[model samples]
Target: MKTTCKSLLLYVLIASVAVNAFDPFTATFVVGVGAALGRWIYEYSQEKCDSKWIAFNATGLETDLERRLFGQHIASRIILKAVTGFMKNDNPKKPLVLSLHGWTGTGKNFVSQMIAENIYKEGMESSFVHVFTSELHFPHPSQLETYKTQLQQWVKGNVTNCAQSMFIFDEMDKMHPGLIDSIKPYLDYYDKLDGVSYRKAIFIFLSNAGGESITQTALDFWSAGRDREEIELRDLEVALSLSVFNNKKSGLWHTSLIDKNLVDFFVPFLPLEHKHVVLCALAEMEAKGLQRNLDVADRVARDLVYFPKPERVFSVKGCKTIDSKLDYYT
Candidate 1:
């Protein structure tokens, strides 16, 4: 009984000391120290942990893009499957898929993310997948040769021998023909080095050249004292039929790079159809409070519809329609 009373007295004294030590500065310091310690522990644990944030899940994404593009989900699934297959086989001998985007579209970021997410959904990590993006910019005359040399080095280092890598070129139209020529050797290297036993890596080049340019030309022609509606419809049809990239030398129109015969897959952008799908997707994201700069989409859509009068069309509030219900058209 005496020992128990002594223990109670000791606890009461400690509690009294703690309660008396109530200086604001001391409390703040204690809290700050605790917060710092907690942060340090969390960071340490994260560094030591092997788990990663999964960016894509097939089951989850099925509902995502499906609400955006109805039947195109089939194509998206195929793309996801193809990339996953490439990841599963450790053999670098698999064919790589190159997805190219048209002018104003950042194919590298968008397509690469989509592909990356799809691969991740299949339980693959970003480090295990190789997605390369080549952006062709018109370099200054003085820096052209140096840039070329650096580009060659980069290709050799990152892209040369990888058996399964996707090379995506954003804004194919902006890519100078000379720049495309420069990369021809790398594509050839991949092709020649790939044996028949190696899984074929696929290349996909997507472009919107045909639709945008044709629509612009038609709008220019129709702007001169002609029936606007008829001209608009005609321009739309022409834009729809316009090829993404036209071979200036051969008169053959293609949406993707043509100098390299090794490119196995070419995807042309159907302006009206592709634009509609993308816009709908953007609208859905916007509705969900996902931030996106719709200005780019607006500009691209206007360029497709009233090529010559893009500025005028954009200025009109109701002229450009996003969805069947959301009209940006003035």
Candidate 2:
């Protein structure tokens, strides 16, 4: 808990000086850039020059990931490096593309929110961030053609408005088979397509596909008595790619996105265990302004369901349902 407190305190202090104001709620910015000045200007906005974290805070983001996001060392490292490199580069050859794969409640969405909050002052609410859910946005199969046209237009329009626009696609497994390929042209390496350059945009896909393979690998590592941190990207990247490509249930099944190597990275989120869940519950306790109680956190963690028969090594739903379980105890 002291670590979290220290991180937050240090971040607040640095953020205050970075923007020349402390309060994240009501501070106004004096942006000089013509493009940035027109933005609705959330509580955080500043002239980004060279890689000074841009409008983003590298230290704060790393602290947040380490302090709150438990388990999955591979994920935290991959996300930080990828984002930092992309943001620092002024002339990226192609937009940053990442596909996060894992079981439910494995912190995919949480990390996504973290990225948004660090980049834009308003976070997910920022107009520059556009989120689309497969189940909600494209529900019908008959409208596949129309959805394709609209999706392309939506992406083009948003990126044209802001060079640093972010696009997040959720539940890709639920999306239609051919739907994802609609925007393939935009994700390619092109200086300008119809007059707009997409080299500065970001695309993130979140899905449950390839989760089974990831869990099995983690289980194997555990059975061997090896450290989870030792499991590197090379260990799972190949198997994950093949599994998602052939898995008929996935939205990217046989899609060109994987075939042509359009995806820059395929990040895997391992299933959570008992210790991780306890940490999550404790964090929840802190967030709720309640006293940190290990007893209550343990009780909440024990109450949640686990899987793999009698061994019960992995969380079935990850930490997705931890908030409600914590609420029961508090």
Worst 10 residues of 2 by lDDT: 42-51
- Highest-TM-score candidate: 2
What's the C-alpha lDDT at position 218 in model 1?
34
What lDDT score is found at residue 145 in candidate 1? 66
Clashing pairs in 2: none
Runs with alpha carbons beyond 4 Å of true place in candidate 2: 1-54
lDDT per residue as tens, model 2, 1-330: 346545555655454456655354334432223224234232124333223322777777788889989998999999999998888888999999999999999999999998888887667877889999987999999999999999999999988877788999999988998788999888888999999999989999999999999988899999999988888888898889878898876788878887778899899999999999999999998999989999998888888788876888888998898898887778
Q: Each prediction's TM-score against the native?
A: 0.46, 0.84
Residue 54's lDDT within candidate 1 is 30
Give the Cα lDDT of each candidate: 0.42, 0.84
TM-score of 2: 0.84
Best by lDDT: 2
> Residue 138 in model 1: shift from native, Å?
3.8
